[model samples]
Target: MTRFALTVEYDGRPFMGWQRQRHGPSVQQAIEEAAFAVTGEVATVHAAGRTDAGVHGLAMRAHLDVAKPFAAFRLMEALNARLRPAPVAILACNEVADDWHARFSCVGRSYEYRIINRRAPLTFERGLAWHVARPLDAEAMHVAAQRLVGLHDFTTFRSAHCQSASPVKTLDRLAVVRDGERVLVRTAARSFLHHQVRSMVGCLAQVGLGRWSADDVTAALEARDRQRLALNAPPDGLFFVAASY
Candidate 1:
């Protein structure tokens, strides 16, 4: 069997998420089906990260094993041809050692959350970004984000349904920046609890809107209680930006 590493990109608007689901279509299902069609065998695609519904992926690394022999470029081209009409695409593919794993071998992951601070209805960016009617203080948001940039128990930011064994995680970076009307929140970590980035973005937004202060953010972190969480940003704005092996 030959193992192939695939760099995938997708628009999250149409599917249920990365994992194969019993109830709806998924990126995994699309790629797996495409792989089966190309290789004439049942194929399972494993990803570096599993995004939530409506969360996009810019470059999610995945891997699959195939029994049929084919050049890396040919395999990638065949998969893309079979994945037509679907939002998912294989940006790059290459042969790799059989022991390499998309998820287990990943060393870091990053995400970006976008917020359009405007009153007017979204025209082109509808469902692609978070629309906040109020003007946001991006600098304040950045300052507040610093509190979350280290190892800590992040219970307040984790989802109740999170399957991770621990609430503690080392947040490598978290920054908020504004470009005209756009507010961007970028974060990186080795791994994250479910909803951690969204939850952090929501609280940072509260800080941006003057609803919370930097001290409040620090207090919330110290509280480490989920109930203290102000909000969980919608998945619409979140994107799995990249994964580092």
Candidate 2:
């Protein structure tokens, strides 16, 4: 058997999430089926992270083991050919050591949240970004976001469904920036709890709207209570930007 690393990109709007689901479609199932079609073997695909429904991926790293004999380039080509019309693409592929796991070996992950700060209705970015009609102070959001950096109990930003052993995590970076009518929130960490990014973005948005002060963010983090969260941003604007090994 051979282990192969894959760089995948997909539109998350058509699936439930990255993992396979009994009631709905998923990115994993689509890729696994495409692999089966190419190799005639049941192979499980593992990803660096599993994003929620409506959360897109720009360069999701994944891996799968196959018993079939094929070159790395040919395997990538075959998978892409079989994955046609699924909105999922294999951007790159390479043979890797058997111990190099996609999830376990990952050292860091990054995500980006996009907000269209405009009153006009979205045309091209309808499902790709969040539209906030009210004007937002990106600088204020950036100031408030800094409070979330470093080690802290992030229960306030964690989802009730989160399975992480502890709510305490070190946020490596969180930055909010605006260009024209676009507000972007970029964050990186070793790993994140369920809805953690969305939750943080939601509270920062409140700060941008002048509803909450920077100290309020500090208070919320210190509270370590989920109810203290100002909001949970929708998945529409979240993107899994990259995963590092």
Predicted structure with the largest lDDT when compared to the true one? 2
What is candidate 1's lDDT per residue for 69-102, written digit by digit as tens? 8899999999999999998889999999999999
- lDDT measured at residue 158 in model 1 versus the true structure, 0 to 100: 91
- What's the true lDDT of residue 231 in model 2? 92
Candidate 2: count of backbone clashes, pairs at least 3 residues apart or interchain: 0
- Give the per-residue Cα lDDT of candidate 1 at 49: 97
- Give the 10-residue window scoring lowest on summed lDDT in candidate 1: 119-128
Instruction: Report the error of model 2 at residue 186, Å.
Output: 0.3
TM-score of each: 0.99, 0.99
Can you write out model 2's per-residue Cα lDDT over 1-245, one digit (the tens) per residue?
99999999999999999999999999999999999999999999999999999899999999999997889999999999999999999999999999999999999999999999999999988888999999999999999999999999899999999999999899999999999999999999999999999999999999999999999999999998999999999998999999999
- What lDDT does model 2 reach? 0.96
